[model samples]
Target: MTSTVLTGISELWTLDPALDDPARPGDVADAQVLRYAAVVIEEGRIAWTGPAADAPAADAREDLGGRAVLPGWVDSHSHLVFDGDRAAEFEARMAGRSYSAGGIAVTTDATRAAADARLRDLVRDRIAEAVAGGTTCLETKTGYGLTVADELRAAQLLDALIAEGALDEATFLGAHLVPREFDGEDGRPGAAQYVDLVAGEMLAAVAEHVRWIDVFCEDGAFDPEQSAQVLRAGAAAGLGLRVHGHQLGRSGGVALAAALGAASVDHVNHLAAEDVEALAATAARPTAPGDRPGLLAVDAGPTVATVLPACDLSTRAPLAPARELLDAGAAVAIASNCNPGTSYTSAMSFCVTTAVLQMHLSLGEAVRAATRGGALALRRGDVGHLGVGARADLHVLDAPAAIHLAYRPGMPMTHRVWRHGQEQPLAPVPPTPTP
Candidate 1:
C-alpha cells in the first residue's frame, strides 16, 4: 500500500478530540486546529496526522503551499431524486404572498412522469453538485414517488447510486404524503386508509432497498397516530428511523419521534420544552471503544436532532433552536435539505454559514455539525471526522482559515476535495434551480 503525506497545510481543522492542541490548550474548544500540519493517507485511510516537522516519512509527499483542510461535509438529508420547476411558487413567496407551496403531491406528479434514465441522470448530477461543493457523503429520500411503483422506482434508483459509489444512504419516505386520491369526507382525506397502504404494501416493496425510513409528521402531513403506524411498520421491515417533524408548527412531532427511538428528528423549528428534553436525551450516549477505538459512538442512544437551516429560511419558517439544543448537550446536525420545494440549494457551505452567522453557532460547532453530526444522524461511523482510523475524506479550502467559509459569503471556497484517498477533479455541474 502506498502512503502519501500532505504537508505544508497552513491550517488543519481536525474534529478528533484525541489530537494534541498546542494552538489553544486549556481553552475548552470543541475542535482542534493545527498549524504547519501534515496528514498521511495510506490505503484509503488516514494513517498519520501531526506537525510537518514530526510527520513520519511516507511513500510520497505533496506540499499544499499553505492551504486549509477540514473534514469533508457530510450532508445527512436531501431530496435529490426528483425533477420539475417550482419557480413560480418561489417568486410568489418573495412577493409577500404567503405560500402554501405545493407539497409532495406536486413533486410526485412530476417525478412519476419523469423517465427512469432522466431521473437517474438528475440524481447523479445532484450528487455531483454536492461533491463539487465539498460534500463527501449524502443521504436522499424517496417521498416524491408515493405509489408502490413510484416509491420502489425511487428507491431502486437511489440504490443504484449507492452501488455506483456516490450516495451513501437511501431513505424510504412512502408515507411522506397522503396523495390526492386518498382525499375523503370532512376535507381531511382517508389518511387512515393511506396509512394502511404505506404500512403494508409500500413498506414491503421498498424495505429491502432502503437503509432508513422517514415520515413527515408535520400538521398537514401525517398525524401522530399515522406517523406511529408508519414508523412501526418500517421498523418491522428492518429499516432505521428518521422523522421530519414540526417544520410547519408544533404538532407533537418531536415527542413521537423520541418515543419511537428514531435515529434523527429533523426540521425542529417549533419545539416545546418537553420536545427539547426528549431530543437532548435522544442524542445522549455513553462513550464507546469499538470501531472508533477511543471515541464516542452508540449502539442506539438519544435521537440525533437535525436542523435544516436552508429549508427554514426558504419557507420563511423560524430557524430551528440550534443553540438551545447544543447547550442542552444534544448532538445536532446542520444539513442542506436540498429539495426543489423548500431548500433549493445543495451547498453545504451555505448551510454551515447560515448556522454560524444567523443561528449563533461558533465556527467549529457549525463545521462539526455539518460533518460529524451529520454522520451520527445517519447512524454512520468513521467517515465524518478525521479520526485516525476513519476514511480519508477531506476538503481543502481556498482560504487560509475555516472562518472564511462565512466571511467570504459565496466565493468558490473549495480548492480541492478528496474522498477515500481519491482526489476528485472539479467538474462544473449545470445550474440546479428551476427557471
Candidate 2:
C-alpha cells in the first residue's frame, strides 16, 4: 500500500479519454497527448495523473526517464490452457489450403495426450510471454479436451494455475468441436449425444473452475441448434456464455449469441444486417441496478462487438467488420485469439496494429478496443482503464506517443510493466554450461 510517484513520463496516454474529468468524455482525440506527464500509484490504484510539474509528493518516486505511460492491454479472448503444436497444419494452410474446425481435433488429441505437469508449464510460459509484452489481464479457455475426463483435467489444470497465482480468468470450451472419436465414422457416437454428454456431465464437472462456456458455432463445428443446446445447458449450470462465431463463414452465430445474452460474440467476421440490428438493440438496452440484465432479457452490453485481428493474420481470413460495427453504434473490443493453429502469438501490440491497418480502426479506436473495450467485452468494470479505484495495472512504452504502437509495428515497444502496484522485473534464466 505504499504510495509512489512515477515521474518523468514523456507522454501519458491515460486511455481514459477524459482530461478534465475521467468520468466525462474529454478531447482524447485532440488533447496535447500530455508531454512530460507523471502518475501517482497508491494501494494498487491510479491515484492522480497530470503534468510532471504538478505531480504530488509521494513516499517514493520512480522516474521513468521520459518513457511513455499507458494503461495495460487487456486480452479478453484466448485458448491458452492446451498443449502441442500445429506447425504442419499451419504450413499447409499457408500454402493455399483452407482451415476447418476439424483442425481443432488435432490439437485436442495433443492436449489430451499431454501430462498435467507439461500442460501447466506450457500455459505458464505463454502467460509469461504475454505479461512481458504488456498484457496485464487475459482470458484463457479449455477447448482441447473433448471428453469428460480430459475436459475435467483441463479445468483442474486451470484451477491449479489459479491457486498458484498464474491465470486470471478461465473458461470452459468443452464444445469446441466434435472430436473424431465422437463421430459416426469413428464408430464412437453421434454429435447430438456428444453435445448432451458435454452439456450434462463434462460441463457440470468443470463449472466450478470456469467463469464462462464457449462453443465453436460454425458449419463444420456445432450447428446453431447444437451450440444453443450447449450454451443453454451451461447457463443452467451457472456458467456465463461466450461464442466463437462467424470466423470461417456466415453461420448465424452472432444473432444466436445476442439471443442467448452471451458475454461477447467473438470472431464476428460474417455478421449480417440482422446481426447489426441485434447489436444495436443490445447496446441500447438498459440494465438493472447492479448493471446486470433482467432474467428474461437477452441484450448484449455496450461493447457488443469484439474484433480478433490476430486470427485474420494467422488464418488468412477476412478481418472483422470493425468500421461497420463502430459506425453502427456498437462498441468493439480487440483480442489476440491466441491458439496454436491460427493465432500462435500472444502479442496484443500486433492485434492493435492489425486492427488499425487491416480493419481501418484509428489509433485511438484500436487502443481503446484493446483496453476499455476489452474490459467491456469481459463485463469487467475495474481492470481496463486508468481511473481512480481501478486496478494499478499499467504498461510503460518505450516511445513517447501511443501512436508508435501502430506506427511502428512488429517492434518491442514495452519498456516496463507493473501489476497490482508492484513493478515486475524480468526473471533471469540460467546460462548454458560449456560441455
Candidate 3:
C-alpha cells in the first residue's frame, strides 16, 4: 500500500504504556511522548511510528512544521439527538436558579414536535462541529424521544451518523426522564410506569440500532430498583450498559452501577467512600465469555468512572471526583457530555483544560482520560491509542507541547484532525446562537 510520512513532530503522545518515554519512569508518568518523531500512515492505520532519524521512508512525505500530535479525543458520552436550544435554562442556572430534571421536558417536547429533516440537519451539524474541535470518536444517545416510535427514529438517525464515520457508538436513553403523562400522584416523573416502558418494548425497539443502553438513575429519574431493572433488561436484550448516575445527588447511583457492571457510569460528582471502593473493585474484576449478566464483558474491559467537567460547570454542580477515582485505582474517563440541556459545548479541549487546572489531573493523565480512558469506557480498544495496528485517528496541535492545551485556555488548539485517516478542516462549523 502507498504511504505518507508525517515528519517534524515536536511531541507525539501515543498514550500507550508500552511505548518508550524518557521524561518519567512510571507507566502513568510516561505518556509516551516521542520528540523529533515521524509517523507513517498507510491504508488508514499507523504503519510505523518512532524517532525521525530511524523512520523508514514512505511513498510521500508531509511536514508538520513542528507540531504536537496525540490520539483524537474520544467523546464517549453526549446527548446530541435533540432539537431546540436550552440557552434560557443555562441563563437561569447562571443566575442561580439551580438546574432540575424538569428542564428536560422542554427539550423533549420540542424534539417530538420537530420535523425529522430539521432534527437530522441539527444532528449532522453538531457532529461536524465536534470533529472540527478535534473529537474523532463520538458517542451520542437518544433520550429526548421518550416514545417507542420517536426513540426508534432517533436511533435510526444515529445509525446515519455511524455510516458517515462521525459517530462510533449509539445509546438508547429512553429512560432519560418521564414525560408529563407519567407524573405520579405525588407529582414526580419517571417514577414507575415510565421505567416499565423503558425496560420493555422501548428497550427492544431501540436495541437493534444501538449498542448500549443508559438510564438517568437519580432523583426525579429512575430510582435504584427501577434503574437496575432497566439495566438487566437491556443486558438480556444483548446491549451493553451505561448510566447517567450521581449528577443530581448521592442517590445510590454509583453503587448500583458497579453492582450491575455498567460499561461506564457518567457524572460521578457524588461518590462516597463506599462508592469509590465499589468502583475500584469493578475496575479490577476480570470477565470472560459466558459470564453472568451483570459482569458480561464489553471488549473485555472494566467499569469506568466518566466525569463530565463541562456538564458540571454548566449545571453549577460539583466536579466529578476524577483524582480520587484515579488514586483508588479505578479507571477514570473525561467526556464532554455534550447536550443542549446540561452541556452545550462539544469542546473536549475545554474539558481537558478544566481537568488539569481545576480537577487536579496531570497533563498526561488528563489526555489519557480523554482518549484511551474514553475508549476503555466504551470497551472499544481499537480507536483510542496509536499502536502500530490501531486506527489512524490523529489530532495535530498547533503548539509544540500538549501542555499548551491547559496553558492557553479558550484558544483553538487543534491544527488538524484526522478520523480514520480523513483530514478534517477547522471551518464551516456549527452556527452560533443569535441573541
Candidate 4:
C-alpha cells in the first residue's frame, strides 16, 4: 500500500486513547488534541501522527492549507431503512399537535409497500448524504419493516452494504412498535402476541444479518417488561443490545438498560437523577478487549446515553441532558436519529453543533461525543479515533479551527473526507438550519 504524509493541519484532534488521562478517561485533554500536526496513512490505517516539523518521509505528501482535521464522525443511532417522508406529520407537530410514537406506524406502512430494490437505493442515497457532511461511520436500524419478511429484507440489504463497505452496523429493531394490524381490536394479534413474534420468529430470521437489537421502551411502544423480553431474546440470539428509551416521558427504559447491560440507550430526553446514576455505574463495568476487527464486541460495558439533538428539535421536545450525563461520569454519544417521522437529515455536523450550543457541551466534548462516544456506544474500538493502527478515516474541514463547527454554525465545513484511506466523492452538502 502506498503511504502518504498529510501536513499543514492547523489542529488535529486525534483523541487517541493511548494519550488519554487514566484518571479521566472521558475527558479530551490537550495532549490528545495536537496542533500543527502531520499524519502518515499506510495500508488503510494510521501509521503515525505528530508535529508537522518532525514528519518522516513517505511515498507522497499532501498539505491541508492550515485546515483542521478530526476523526470522521461516527453516527451510532439512525433509522435509514425506510421509504417515505413525514413532512405533513412534522408540519402538524409544528402547528401545535404533539409528537407521538404512533407516527412510526405511518412509515411502517410505506416501508412495507416499497420494492426491495427501491429500498436499497433509498438507503444508498441517505448514506451518501451522511458522508457529504463528514459522517464516516454510521449505524442504521431496521424498524420500519414490522413484518417478518420485510424486516428480514431490510437486514439483508444492510448486510450486503456491509459487504460492499458502504455501511458499518445494522440493528434489528423488530420491537420498535406493535404493528397497527396487531391492535387486538378484532381477531388480530395484540401487542403481547406481536412481541412474541418479534422475539421468536422475526429475531430468528434476521439475527444473523444484524449486529445489535433494539426495542422502543416507552409508553405507546413496549413497556419495560415487554422490552426486556425482546432484549433477552436478542441476547440469547447472540446479538448485542440497544434501546430506544425515554424520549417522551419518565419511562423505565433507563433503569432497564442499566440492569440489562445494554450497549446504548438513545433519545434520553427525560432522565432522573437516579437514571443518570445508574447509567454512570455502567462506566465502571468491564469491557471486552479492543482487538476485534470490523466487529462490535457484544460483551458487558456501560450503556451509552446517546442523545439525538435533531430529533429533539424537530419534535419540539426538551433537549437531552447531555451536560449532566457527562458530569455524572456516564459516557454520552450524539447521533442524528435520521428517520422519516422525526429527524430526516443525516447531518452529523448539525448534531455536534447542537450538542455544543444548546446542550451546554464544550466544542471538544461535543465533537468527542459524536466521534469516540458513538464508537463506545456501538462497542467498537477501531473507527472513532485517529490513533495509531486505527482505520485511516479522516474528516478535513474547510475552516482552520474545529470551533467553527459551532462558531459558524449552519455553514458547509466539510472540505474532504477519507474512509479507510480512500477519498470519498462528496455531494453538495445542504446547509443546516440556524437554531
Local distance difference test, each candidate: 0.83, 0.79, 0.85, 0.91
Model 1 lowest lDDT segment of ten: 20-29
> Each model's TM-score, in the order given?
0.92, 0.91, 0.93, 0.97
- Clashes per candidate (backbone, < 3 Å): 4, 0, 0, 0
User: What tens-digit string does per-residue lDDT give for candidate 1 at 1-435?
Assistant: 899999989888777756534353212244467788999999888888888999999999998888999999999999887989677777777787554524667888989999898888888888888999999988999999888999999999999888887888899998888888786666755879889999999889998898889999876788888999999988888777889988888877789888888878899999887788888776545434434332233236568889998988888888998988888778789899998888898899998889988998888779988987887787766777787877799999998888999999888999899998889877888765542
Clashing pairs in 4: none
Deviating ranges (above 4 Å) for candidate 4: 294-296, 429-435
**Is candidate 1 or 2 superior in lDDT?**
1
Candidate 1's C-alpha runs over 4 A off are 17-31, 99-101, 185-189, 287-299, 431-435
Task: Report the C-alpha lDDT of model 4 over 392-425, residue by residue, as the tens digit.
Answer: 8999999999999999999999999999898999
lDDT string for model 2 (145-220, tens) is 8889898988888877767656666889989988887786756788988999888989889999977788989998
Model 1: lDDT of residue 340? 80
Q: If both were scored by lDDT, which would come out higher, candidate 1 or candidate 4?
A: 4
Candidate 1's C-alpha lDDT? 0.83
Model 2 TM: 0.91
- Assess the local accuracy of residue 35 in candidate 2 as a C-alpha lDDT between 0 and 100: 80
